[model samples]
Target: MKAQFPIFDICKLSRCEQEDIFISRLAPFLDKHQNLLLSHKHTFYHIVLFTEGAGSHDIDFQRFLVRPYQIYFMGPGQVHSWSFEGKVDGYVVNFSTQFFQSLLLKADYLDQFPFFNGNVAEAVIDLSTNLHPLILDLFEKLVHESETVQHLRQDMVRVLLVQLFIQMDRLSFERPVHQATAYNYTLLRNYQKLVEKNYTSLKLPREYAELLFITPGHLNALCHEVLGQSAGEVIRDRIMLEAKRLLTNLSLTISEVAYQLNFADNSYFTKFFKKHTGLTPEKFRDGLFNQLSQDALSLQ
Candidate 1:
């Protein structure tokens, strides 16, 4: 199959870019997108729910046929492409990373949400039947910003985002942790944010600890207490995930990918990758390619 055409971040639209979000119904453009199957890299954050149509998304190698009210997480740096038949309709809520960063200051508990891992996770309850109206209303408010009265625009947006996060929190599998942390909890949370934002760059624990205004030891202790993993371990997982993403999606050679990942040399990157994957880079790629070919042959 041909790789899909490139996808753009909707927030980059002229008007929407200023507001940090873009929302639109899908049916109108579904005809253009369905056959073309335009897919490529994206860096913005979003949560797309199919409110009115039955369609599908090609996420990595997983093809999820999106039914009505199905919600899929659109994380930063993940590659996603779409397709549908006539009148394919849904709502796309595009938001900036800043929006989520600030929201996490409050609903950080979503860190345990499992569906964010490039999988089509179903919500336990079909909240979209009720929640869709709220999102539509919020989108209307966002659409007609001129109507936002003096001193009320930011206030309205803050409330709207909070509501959205609340809905997401309800869907998370982790039983809610209502005990709002005291002053010290901020350290781990901030450290987590740092890891998320700069994991590709910061290889050492001290780098993150210094940024969070804490010692390496304290950072390690906090993560171990709450997550059963040290700060370094968390950083490694994020880096390794990015590495795997490139390996699976891009056509770059191992040495080229290693340089892009900031390894001092190919050998070091190979060792690091093998440590986690239990196979050399060449063997790993061959294994996945073989699996894909076998699946294709089986389908035939």
Candidate 2:
């Protein structure tokens, strides 16, 4: 059997005695683990701030250019890969999902932050020159905290991390346009959560609407008004994303992938994948391998 797509957890990546969290200067971290250059998923929350670098990173198939003082956040299970042009150095912090659960009263406190909400566009942030020094200081403190065995070390790290998140959130440019009313936004978020949890088995808008305690028409209207897409489209996008993630694992056959995704059959799955991505599953996997090969060659 071929190798499965890489999914890294905090325990596997942590160099320190603390298994729940890992923090270090990005350059050495990258040097120590070159495999991170390839596509993989993380089982922990991944945060990076680039002080100096020129590169492109793909988060869930969306590519973004790297720049100085730019930071990116990734919630667990998001597929990402990096291609750097020159020496990359900054700060990187990886913490398990439970890192904050015990520290904070609210279990979903991280989810409240836009960066941790699993939206690639919102997760990557560019800080202004005025804010760079302040953000840099916070990261420095986090690095120092991680290096030393001080009193309340983990708590201090959590405080600094939360402060960093708030600082980024306060930036005017960081905010995405608010299209949904508070009620609609809450409802939409709930709907999205349900879709994420049940997408593999529930494919219809009405099914989700029933779960949301609203009519299908209401759900469709809300999705269009807030997301600029139909409710069905939103569910379809989630399903398609999972299909792509699964396809990255070369060991999984097309039929197996389809079965795992709860598709009717292999043919139907192929048609769906092709319709959305314009490439069959096999072709898509082949392209990924070719791209990885080219990337490896370029690095050499």
Candidate 3:
């Protein structure tokens, strides 16, 4: 049978009882939440403002230490979990992609923020204490607007979210030194978007380079300079991530997983998976289930 992961959609979770936006205090939210505090993906976006709490959060397999005056931004499709000691006091705001896209118009409008960048490996933003009031004020406004139907409440919420996004972008972690040039940055972002869209069918570095109107060598250099990974590695990583996702669904046979991922054959897919992840497909899937079981046992 297919192993299923919980996908929390804001609209569904809200049950139309509220708007597409949902806000709650972090401590109580965590008290009622179990699945998402562990590894899970959301169908909508999450902006967490950690006014008080200290621990770690894992996003897409990368773990980040959490601190007060810190905020975390997670986009749709990212897998994440959090573990913190002691009381966690803060706010969590979840809004649907539809909620923002209806206002922004651009399909990839969210991509403009550095933390939301597809190529970015981390998204934690630490701000100075002085900025906490301003940040918290915006969050409070979002919560207030979500509760009552006021004139232009939707507009006010959108305005606050945009302001929060802009402020958070300013506080985002700095890009690598090599990403300074606007041209290189733009090219890199374009490549990332292309990879997300076409990683399954367009597997080769040259294919992406052709789409970007650049030589394979230039693309490779840009990838290495800005992301510290070769163009091929980035492509492989995306494929591997998808492979893992599929493997979690026990309903799919190994061969089926390979076929779904566009591999020519099962054996070749196993080789590719092992090369990048140091585990055969079967072992990888078994290991993941075993680890999940252990986590459940420990919690009990």
Best by TM-score: 2
Residues 1-300 of candidate 2: C-alpha lDDT, one tens digit per residue:
233458888877875467888999999999999988988899888999999999799999899999999899998889999989888999999998899877899988876666776667778888889988899999999999988998999999999999988887666233544455779877987888888789999999999999989999999999888778899998999898889888888878899999999999999999999999999999988888788777666667
How do the residues 138-168 of candidate 3 rate in per-residue lDDT, one tens digit apiece?
9888888877889988878889989998887
Q: Where does the lowest 10-residue lDDT sum fall in candidate 1? A: 116-125
Candidate 1: clashing pairs of residues: 5-38
Stretches of model 2 off by over 4 angstroms after superposition:
1-4, 169-176
Decoy 1 TM-score against native: 0.60
| TM-scores of the models, in the order given | 0.60, 0.91, 0.89
lDDT of each: 0.61, 0.86, 0.80
TM-score of 3: 0.89
- Model 1 CA deviation exceeding 4 Å by range: 1-7, 11-21, 27-29, 35-39, 52-76, 81-89, 95-185, 213-217, 248-251, 282-300
lDDT, candidate 1, 14-111, per-residue tens: 34544565545555444443432444556666666566665567665356776776666666666555656445566555665565555446554444
Residue 67 in candidate 1, Cα distance off native in Å: 6.9
The ten-residue window of minimal lDDT in model 2 covers 171-180
* Shift in Å, residue 42, candidate 2: 1.6
lDDT of 3: 0.80
Tell me which of candidates 2 and 3 scores higher on lDDT. 2
